[model samples]
Target: MTSVTSLPASEQEGARTSPEDPEKLEDPEKATLSTDPSETSLPNNKRVEQPTKINWLLTCVGLYLGALLYGLDTTVAATVQASVYEELGNLQKLPWVGIGFPLGSVAVILLIGKLYDTFEIKWLIIGSVTLFEAGSALCGAAPTSNALIVGRVIAGMGGAGMYIGALNYISIFTTSMQRPIYNALIGLCWGTGAILGPVVGGAFSDSSAKWRWAFYINLPLAAVVSPLYFLNFPRYNPQPEHTALEKFKQIDWLGAFLNASTFVLFILILSFQGPIWRWAAPGSIVLWVLFGLSLISYGLQQTFSILTSPERRLFPIDFLARRTLLLMFFATSSAAAATSVTLYYVPLFFQFTKGDNALEACVRLLPFIVPFVFFVMFSGGLLPVVERYAPWYFPAGVLMIVGGALMYKVSPNTYTAAIYGFEILIAIGTGLVFQTGYAVVAAKVPAHRVAASIGFINIAQIGSICITLAIAGSIFGNLGFVKLEHVLTGYGFTDSELRSALAGSFSPVFQHGDARARKLAIEAVVSTMGTSFALVFVAGAVTLVSAFCMRWEKLGLQTTAGG
Candidate 1:
């Protein structure tokens, strides 16, 4: 027991004050008091207050639920896109549902991360969850593709906040020894969500009574979790208060704007090519120029902010200066890119090559779902017991490369078991990297900046997803579909029938085609997918680069200068 009055002001405020703050009660001639309580006995009645024990089980459950919602929104839309397009009457705009969510998410994540740093996380959680639910409702009721895209954008903002906020809270509540397990649980949430989203979406779409129920599903879950989040999550208020104007000044709104502009330009270039515009179209050139300029502007802004006001900038120079942080950023980005490409193409293969409907395709992809769930939970449980996490990255990277290579060999006649095996490899690889990367970032950065750092990492992940998906879509549209359709017309299929078949995905082509035409279409499909799989190899190379960036020893127990 130690009495408050006996301790100096410095010691009294040790946990609260920044290290850079002046020692207000220092006496120049006196020696500093020892932090050890054994030096002086305290009054029997006085005792130090220990921190409250967090409801770990509930927090984990809540985070899992939040992550599940995010995965559901992202993946479920892909399977249901044809169904939605049938009702919405805009086949050309179908890609918007996928592109909009990640685009909106990447734009706000950096700013929201800074907000998490400067304000209480309680408000962020509350606001984001509320907005997400509202967006869900809007999406469920959407009458057109445009309205659904808008709702998804709103939902994306909320999802970004939840992702950053949950990771931040998990870091706050857990000790170093406990952090790996918690991080792993976050990965588990993602894997579970990925597994559930397609199944749920496909089932609802197949029922046809209410395809909109997929969006409505999030409402009840959110209602149950909101109150628990409010009650159990700790509050994080900033010590130095600033006005709304000052707070706005702190955020790099220009950076956010540039980021969004870059993504939109890239997506437009990818999705519109050959569909609405030629490859060498003036619009494509204009978008490419805009993207390049936006990127340059963003880089300059970040550099200038660091140089001019290193101390006050939202992304402090210290966080970026660390090699580990840089490595983790690249690692997470590559890993995200890899996962998105795999998820994007798997269903495409099923739809085109195997001639399966969305519901049947989802069921066929269970190999992916089963492995992801098992490996994620297993990894989460094992992280606490393991002494070193760095070695795990190698296996993860290898599995990813292997999976991508297997996918490169996929043909219309290839056995379903082979595809399942490849998917399993992908699932394991993704599980290995997802949580491990977060753990490394958290471990390397200071406690106070954990939320902000994790926020940046989340941005990198979503940003990579947006960029990769756009790239994949571009490749698929340009190389696969356009050529296949031309080849089909040469085989004497009528314009209307060919248009109808291509409009609904490649499945309908197999149903109506002669044996020779079907063979050629399958070969073209395989060649197209092989090109996409080549992109995964690039992702694997990026993973190796990420591995080179991690410095395990350097990351241990270091504080940022401002702390």
Candidate 2:
């Protein structure tokens, strides 16, 4: 290994050896050196750091279980939304329950990632878990819609922190090759919690237990796992000592605030459009303008301000400016957009078009859900073995496109086997792409910038999910209602019946009198959903196109200093 004194400042900060110099790099473990500033900067300050031997199995169990906490809230909350609405009698406040956590999470994610980069990770992990537990307690005990929403937001911050913290944690302990395995496990756990969330919520909702138990469930698990965090987690020496005021100046507070505000407002605009106001309504227009201004201001801040100057930009513009990263962003966004939209609508296809009950549709979705987790784990396992990640990128794109195309052909009477095959295809495709961003980013970025890089990737995924859901909702709202109204009127259903049907769930249309009218309404739903799924195909196509620009890179086991 090269001495710190021998390298240039750029190298010290996070420069890597040229690919031509691969033979000169350290063993993979040595290559992933702790980027603690105190270790590198103080030449004579003899800090004899040594690697901590971890029980990887115990570590994996603790980490994946912690990962599940983030997903449980969303899934469980979604399941109990109806009961919540019934009990609270304020349906308008319901969306806030969803909005609050992500908003709080977005606010802190960018900064928190950087914090983990330079601080004691153990405390951060423990604190985040404690925060999550605290929020869960509040939600379980909340007496009003507003109270629950507030608790959700607090917990969301903790979750966002946990997610990034998990990434940082793996990077700290596991070699580059081992990271995908842990990432896969974490992704699968999160995915499992999500798939099971509604079911668990339903169980509690139906049982003598209150829906609040859904939130409360997190308590014991968190309590049990926190001890492992302290015992097994490695420690890093803090960066060169600085006074409180000096260290405070180092953070990009302005940039973080601006970016957080912009995302929150963006979510607000989407949340308001349907539940509260029309797009053309004054409230919508006002929020739209606010969102636009906030975004523009954030961009300017990143470009100009000292707090968010080019050197310390909250988003790390130079890193993201690379063609490879941009394409990755596009690929992830398109894939997430595709998967999220499909996940949102596929169950509807079974429920509305085929008239399966909600529970039955959920059960039918198990094929897709099960394969998704399997492939996510499978792909994670595979990445470590593959010589080049780029080769796998193409197949991921191909499978997503193929799966999405098949999904587009779905109808009320489509073969059960066909849908199952299509879902499995998509699931496998998703698993391939899901971890690509994290692994590739880790491979490319310097240790100092790793957390920031992961956070950026996280933001892209979240942004796509939010935007895709909103667009999908709009399309479903516009197309479903229009088609049903036209079909119902054609079948001699009165305008009043059409109005009532349009205002609520389409299930009633099937329940109403007149068999012919029901048939038309069912057809209308199928047609509308087909159009929606077609957009998912579009998402797949976008991913395929973007994959071309994502450069092929080999995952070398040899590590480089602070790489």
Instruction: Please list the Cα RMSD from the true structure of every candidate, rounded to 1 decimal place.
Output: 7.0, 6.1
Tell me each candidate's TM-score: 0.84, 0.82
lDDT string for model 2 (1-563, tens) is 11122223342332232323445232222233222232222112222133334444555666778778786664455446546665764555665665566567767778887676556666787788889889989998989998998898889888877877777777655555456666667788877776666566656765678688888988987878777776665444334455446655777888888888898787777666655677799999999998899899888888776554554567777655566667667777776666665565666566555555445555666877887788778766776666456665577778888887887777778888888788778777776777567766665654545566687777766566556655665565556667877766656565444433422243345556577776777677767667766766777777777777666656553222221
Predicted candidate 1 versus true structure: per-residue lDDT over 1-563, tens digit per residue = 21122323333322222224345212111112222222221112222222244444565667778987887776677677767867786666777777777776777777778777666666788888888888888889998888998988888888878877777766654555455566676777765676666677778877865568888888999998877786665554543357666765766666667656766777777888766677788987887888899878767766787323543454444556566667667767777777777776787678777777777887876777777667766665655456455655677778888888888878888888888888888777776676666766655443345565677678668888877877876776567765577677677665434434443553456677788887777677667877787767677667766675554342222111110
Best by lDDT: 1
Looking at candidate 2, the ten consecutive residues that score lowest on lDDT are 39-48
Error of 1 at 174 (Å): 1.9
Clashing pairs in 2: none
Q: Candidate 1 at residue 504, lDDT? A: 50
